[model samples]
Structure formats: C-alpha cells, structure tokens
Target chain A: MDHSSKRGDRPGVSRRDFLRGTGAAATAVASLVKVPGVEAQEAKSGADVVAIGPGPVKLSLEVNGTTMTTNVEPRVTLLDALRNYLDVTGCKKVCDRGTCGACTVMVDGKPIYSCTMLALEAEGKKIRTAESLIDGGKLDPVPAAFVACDAQQCGFCTPGFVVAMRAVLDANPKATPAEVEKGLAGNICRCGTYEQMRHAIEDLCKAGGK
Target chain B: MDNFVYYRPKTAEAAVGLLDAKWGTAELLAGGTDLVSLQKQYIARPKKVISLSQVQGLDQIEQSRGWPMTFKIGAGVKLATLAASSALRGSAAALAQAAEEIAGPQIRNMATLGGSLCQRNRCWYFRDEQSPCLLKGGDKCFALDGENRYHAIFTQGRKCVIASPSTVATPLMVLGAIAQVLSPKGKREIPLAEFFKAPTGPEDREHVLAPDEMLLSVSFSIASDKVKSASYEVRQKLSSDWPLVQASVAFELDGGTAKNVRIALGHVAPVPMLSAEAAKAIEGKPINEETAAAAGEAATSGAKPLSQNGYKVRLLAVAVKRALLTAAGAKKYWEV
Candidate 1:
C-alpha cells in the first residue's frame, strides 16, 4: 500500500521530485499552494505527471473548430462547460443524467452524452455540438430532412436527435433506415414524434445522394 | 457534484501513486458514466479524483500468438469499439453481442469496459442519498420488503438483493476471461469468475479491487475454432433500458454434440451467476428443443423468488434457452 518506496524503482523522475526541482525558492509554499496552470503546462511539455486543483484550473477546449479557454473545477461536466462557461449552448440539458440523450454531442467524430464526460477529459480533442450542424447558414441534410418531414413537436429532443442522426449519416451516408434507427436508439422522443421521425429517415434514405 | 482535486497521471505507475491508501478518500475516474452520477447524488464524495484518461497505452486491443492465441483488451476500450471489433466478433462473439445490446449509441460511445464492470448496482434505495439502505450501512434493506419487483430472486443468503447490472460481465464470465490489475505493489492476474463477489457487508464492493489498485486490461483465450458463443437479453423495451434478465452461453461443438458448455445469467443474482446445472444438462448432447428446454429449467433450479419478482424466474429460464439456441445457430422457438 505504501507506493512511495516503489516510485524510485521507475525510470522517470517522480512528480514530487519534479515539482521540487522546478521551484526551489517557493519549496515551502509550493506544495501547499497549487498554481493553476503550472503543472498542466508541464504535462503538455511531455512531463510524466500532472496535478491540478481542488480549485479552478485553466482549461482549453477546441469546440466547433474554435479553441476557447476558461477556468473551472474538475467536477464540471463537458455539457456545463459548454453551456455555462463557453457560451456554446446548442446542447440542451434535459435529464442531466446519461439516460436521456438530450445532451448528445460528437467527440472525435463519435456521438457521446456530453453530460457524462468531464471537461478536463475533453481537452486536446475535437468537440462538435448541435450548433455545428450548419455550414455557411445552410442547414445540414439531417436537420433539413427533419424540417421537411416535421419530425419534431416540442423541439426539446431535436438538437440531440439531429446531432446523433448526423453522426450516423456522416459515418455512412448510404446507411439504411434500419441502420439509422439502430444508431438513434440512444435518443428518446417523449413528445411522440417518432412517427414523423420515421418519415424523415425514409426521406433521407431515399435521397441517398444527400 | 462536489469539487475534488484532480490528478492526471501519464503512466500506470503514476496513477497508482496518486491513489490514497485509505479507501473512500480517493477514486479512479475512467469514463465518468457512473462516477459522475454518483457524485451528483452524493453517494460518492471522494476528496481526490485520479483520472486514468491521460495514462498511456490503456486503450489498445492487442493479440498475442501462442498455443491458445489470446486477445488482450485494455480496460479503457470503449463499448462501441468492443461491439465493432472484428477480432472479438470472430473469437468472442458473445462479448460483442452483450456490448452491442447495452444502453444506446451515445452511452456505448462514452462508457468504457472497466467502468461498466465496476459500476454499482441500480437499486433505487441505495442510490437515494437520504434512504440509508443496508448497502449504505443501514440496519435494513429497503428493496427486500418495499418495492421488491427488481430485487434478486436467487438471494443465496445475501442481505442486499440488488441484481447485478453489468451486461458485459455475464459474457465475460462464460468466456473465462482474466483481469489484469495493477496495484502500488505491482501487477497480478485474477480470473473473472473469482473477481466478482456478492457483497457480504456495507463496506464490500461488487468487485475485489482495492482502493489503491486499478484494472489494467482483460485477456481471454479461445481454445479452438469449434468454440461457439452468444448472448440473449430480455428487456421490457427494445430501446435504452436495462435487461430484465440476460443469459450468455459458450461451448465447443464436436461433430454433432456440445462439449464444455457454460451458461451465465445476469440480473437474477447479486453477481453474474454461473449455472453448472444448466451446463450439465447440455454437455455431451446435441443441442435441440428438448435439451435446451431442460437446460433452461435446470438454470432456475434453486431460485427462491421474493414477493413481487417471481416473474423474473420464468424470464431467466427463457433467456437461457434462447441463448443456448442462438449459440447453436438453431431455429428460434419463439420466431417459429
């Protein structure tokens, strides 16, 4: 259980030793007072270890092709970080828990529940929210299809459904209706818009060229 | 969620170093599907949170060549990757099928193998922060007398009746997988069958991992090309809901007979229960309607259902029969 003895057997310098070597003048106060970005910068500089805070730490997120910097605690979720701090509020918070896919977003081209992921874990990765579905003011084919078929009622679940459907179509544009349905099984439409959603899926599948 | 200090270690050794020796003071965060929810509910309030995301080489699936070629899957591998892995589809199809049926696309994209295996049971009383159930160090189990529908039918003398929630553990138990764990001392290997345990007290967890130890990877071997496996889950709805009862079966087929059959059931017991009686009914016999039916009946031999969960006993039987039929690639009775 005593891990300190085994740290010397490893090849690289321990995190404590590295911290000690970095600031000799502030050795007494350095361990007690944690600097916000010092250890994180060392981690990015290829250091073996990084320790951030019980307090707010500097966080940089590449969201919608823009790098936004902020400071937040580790407990903040990616959904909260996007909606509260970064001012990118396309992803809605319905269930807050991961059950309802109301907070779906794409991380590194895969659809995930943003509420279940930490903002710190999303660093150095590409994040795409429902806001990214438009290009040059033109709606993506998935949302356009939803609009044409009137696939939404209250519009609460639309953003998550659109992002999730876009992911399926982006992965396979020629995906069958069954494939799309399987891909969208995570999202729920409590407003009973599933019948209309099927029409939208059918239209998209028939249009295949889109 | 309560705020905690975070440490992102780049190595497995460093991650273990960051763990506190005392339990309940620190927790390892990997794909926070369960931990975040627990934190929000105040069920878990660790002072230190060690993230395994920054650790190198914990996300790769590698195969080793030997007498029985083994596949080693890192604990951090996502459920989506597991469901789509061609390597697993050929050798461990049951595991792939279980992974595919879990939750929905969004959850599968974020939840990791290690996180799923280590997640807590879904009993509402245990989850409610104010309930103070037996699992939470209280005097009584709320599920035992109140709202006993989702409680376990096969109690096996355990006080807590919360059913096992991991769909993946059922298939892994049937495959005889091995868990590789890294502690502050070093590394050790534990068989999947021995790794899971029914909690005997308030302090016991579903698994035997120490607070200072972490699950590194899981490795399972296919004995031969004749191995066939499949998993079947019975749920109230086809969408994103936990299975009412699930069964996974694995066995090697000789010319016209089944050999070494293994059956594991979930959501019916505290841990994924391996049914030797069910396997015995099918061993050395050709898989057919009669044999599979007999195996199904044998699977629920010792069940002692609670007040409202007697229906689950029948569902567990049907799940076993269907899993056996699916593994053999035989005609499904329900479909016919």
Candidate 2:
C-alpha cells in the first residue's frame, strides 16, 4: 500500500534509526526486511489470508508527523510498537487491557486505547500521542494547563489524561462540567487527582484552551 | 502473546475468505478492544489475524425516513459515535443510552457494535487461562461452584454461568433489530431474538455466527408514535465498570394505557432475555405506579439464581421497573 503519499515525509528519520531507538535487536530487524515478499503474496492474492508466522514482517506507521518503517510481529500492539519501536514512550502502559486509559492516544482525531490496537492496523492512519504535544521544548496548552492546576500526583497517568483533555477541548472548547466528566471517564488516577483535573479542565474551558 | 500472521484486507470478501472452519485458523480483527485482550489472555490464539480496518463502507450509519423509519448501522461503527449521534437519540434512544453507558470513553471510541456483541462472557474462570471451564472443553464450569456472584440468574447451571455482557444487546433486542450476516455461502438476515442461543453443549457458542461469517450491519426501525423506548443500567460505579443489572423497555401506549410492551434484561442470564411475563402483565393496563411496580415484580417469575447471585433477582426487578417507567415518560421517576 502507498502509505507515504497520504502524509508528507521527513528526511532525517531513517527506519534503522527508529528501530534502534525502539531497542530492537539488529538481527531481528534484518530478518523482518526479508520476509515481506512471501507474506505479501499470501495476504494480497486469493489464497488463504490466515497464514501462520512466527517471524517479523516489514510494517510502517504514520506517527506524530512522520512515517517510520520497522519490522515487528503481527502480535505487537500499537502501544508496544510506539514505546518499543519508535521510542515514543509518552503514552504510558498500565493495565495492558482496555480498562485503564493510561495508553490513550488519538487515531484520526479520535481517542482510543492504544494497548488494544494492533500496530499493523495503524499502518496509514494519523496517530497523535502525548509525545506530540511537546513541540520544540514547549508544552502544549493542555499539558501546560495540567501543570498549572497541579492535576497529577504520581505522574504515571498524566500523559493519557493530557491527551484525553486535548481531545475533549479540541472537540468542545466550551465543554460543560458534565461533558468533561463524561469525556474523561475512561482514565483513572490512582492518586485521586480527579478534583484537580476537573479544575484544570474547567480552567481550560474558561480560557478557550488558551 | 502468540505470533500470528496479520492480514489487512481492503475488501469485505477478502476478509471473510480468510476464515476457516478450524477454531484458531483465522479471526476477524474489528475494533480490537475485545479481540486483543482475548489474545493477551491466551483465550484466543489465532494463527492468522485478519484486520477489517481497510474494508470500506462498514463504518457509516445510514438512516431511512420513510415508513417504518430505520437506522442501518454498520457493524464497524464506533460505539462513541453511535452513542453521541443525534439521529439515534430521536428514534432509537435506548440504543444510544446503552452505547453511552458502555465501558469508558476510550473504549467506546474503539469498540464496535459487532465486537461488543461477539465478545465472550467475562466469567473469571472463562477468562483465566488456568481454569479449564466447560466452555473450554472442560468437564465442569468453575463459576457453578466458585465465585458465583456474577453468574446468571435466569439460565443458571445449564452449561455456563456467565451472563451476556453486551450492554447494546439488551436494547437491540427490545427494538426488534435484525442482524445482516455475510457468510462465504451467502448473505442472510436474522432477527436479534434468534441471534443469540443458550449453550446446549460443550462445543456450542453464544451467537449463531459461523466461523466464516461476518456481521455486516444491524438494522432496526422506530416508527410508531405510540411506542416509547428507554434503557436503564445500574452499575457498581459511575466510572467504566460492567453493569450489575441492565433493563430496556419499549411500551406501546394508547392514551396512557399500555397496549403492548417489550421488556428485556441483561447481565442476569446467559443471553439478553425478553421478559414475556412482565410484558404480559402490563398489557392493556394503565401505566401507573401500581401497575409498573406489579410488572416489575412479575418480571422475576422464572429466575433461578445460583447460590450467591440471588441478590441479582431484586436488582433485576428494580431495573425493569425503572426502565419501564422511563419508557412510559413518567415524570420524577428517577427521584423515587
């Protein structure tokens, strides 16, 4: 599939550099580049698509503002791919199941649990994680609001909350208290910082997301 | 997680053609909110994971406004979109309410209608890889004798104790929805009532979906002015938690008198159950406090709760009563 045409490309980010950033073994990346031709035929042709594989295959992801290519097993989740392959670890991984919103990210402007999503399915989609909010050492308005209101306690779930808050505010800048509560219901803070988070959200809604 | 070949098919036919009769040969990946978790827990280890993300036209919601106004909801439509849809709120209010109350925002943003209905029971024994339950080809179900708190109250001890966990299923059943299923053989439509089946044996599954078939869309009509429909769910927490009891009601009223009624309950049985007795009790009766309460009492007629889940009987009755009152447009019912 032509994934690059949909999104413009960046020059400096190489596939090997991204794989190295993800901390994958050099041999594993080597084997992944070689297995694509055989798997591509099985997947595209009328032959059975349920082909078995214990090897890595070439995959590309459009993350943040760049298209990064890598090799990974089909079983690797989006959460694992972002953290391990692309070194975009801002989205925390807690309660690998969909219950906790700690791994929340935006896919085509919609917030979804990255832990439950497969990396292969996100090949050509526009993905925005918490890492994208930090542009040139400046925090995005949502994270700034979070810091201003002291909305985090242990800081483990802060990125997910920030992403969720960004999504909610972007969709409804003047969101009511009820809407904020409903929109952020997926995320939980073990440190009991919900009251502070609400305060931050209310502040943002008042400021029109600054 | 077990390694599997991932195929992203651009066409619906290609997606279904990947399916084989074997249990773990290939599994459809829709939304991945439930399927990924099942794979993580080792409950579902398919050799091939066929992703339907690239398949076109399965993510749109089409509405028709003629006689028998209906909404043809694509099975792949996100739950959050369905919940927040203003079109659905006007006619299919119960479905919107059910969608709004399922899980949390992140999960709702990713979970699809087909995925929610096809998700297996959340029985701890069934979810735990260590326990060899009856559904997993074991001799006995551990939920029958251990940790029976969340087990079924209506269909207890049949073969599995896990209740149907689909929050949307209850409302769909009350709306008399029809599921359009596409098989390798052909396309067929089945009513929601006949879509789910109780497990008759060890090899049986919950829904009638074959291994090679895929759910295309779920269509339901909401036309009559006399019909008022609503859904009520009572959960242990206000956050994203599985509902303890859920009830959906659609009442056909003629000048405050219930001409006909449909009441369905979830999380209390192996399937989303239509309470015929409750509906019969309120038929032709004025929808008042006394009649509503009586209908609620009659709804628990054939409940056979397990040792620890007897408390669900009262919870189910209360949910039914509240749901019926909500559907009847009774003022100040939530206050009581």
lDDT of model 1 at residue B248?
A: 97
Q: Please state the CAPRI-style docking class of candidate 2.
A: acceptable
Question: Tens digits of per-residue lDDT for model 1 on B35-120?
Answer: 88998998988777788988888889997665476888999999999999987888888999999999999988888899988888
TM-score of each: 0.90, 0.91
Q: What is the DockQ of candidate 2?
A: 0.35
- For candidate 1, what is the DockQ? 0.35
Error of 2 at B305 (Å): 1.2
Candidate 1 chain B least-lDDT 10 residues: B63-72
Q: Which regions of candidate 2 fall more than 4 Å away from where they truly are? A: A1-23, A26-54, B200-202
Q: lDDT per prediction?
A: 0.86, 0.83
DockQ of all models, two decimals each: 0.35, 0.35
Candidate 2 per-residue lDDT, tens place, B229-329, comes to 88888888986999888999887778778875888889888888899999999988887778888888898998998889898889888888888777777
Q: Which residue runs of candidate 1 sit more than 4 Å off their true CA positions?
A: A1-47, B65-67
Collision pairs in model 2: none
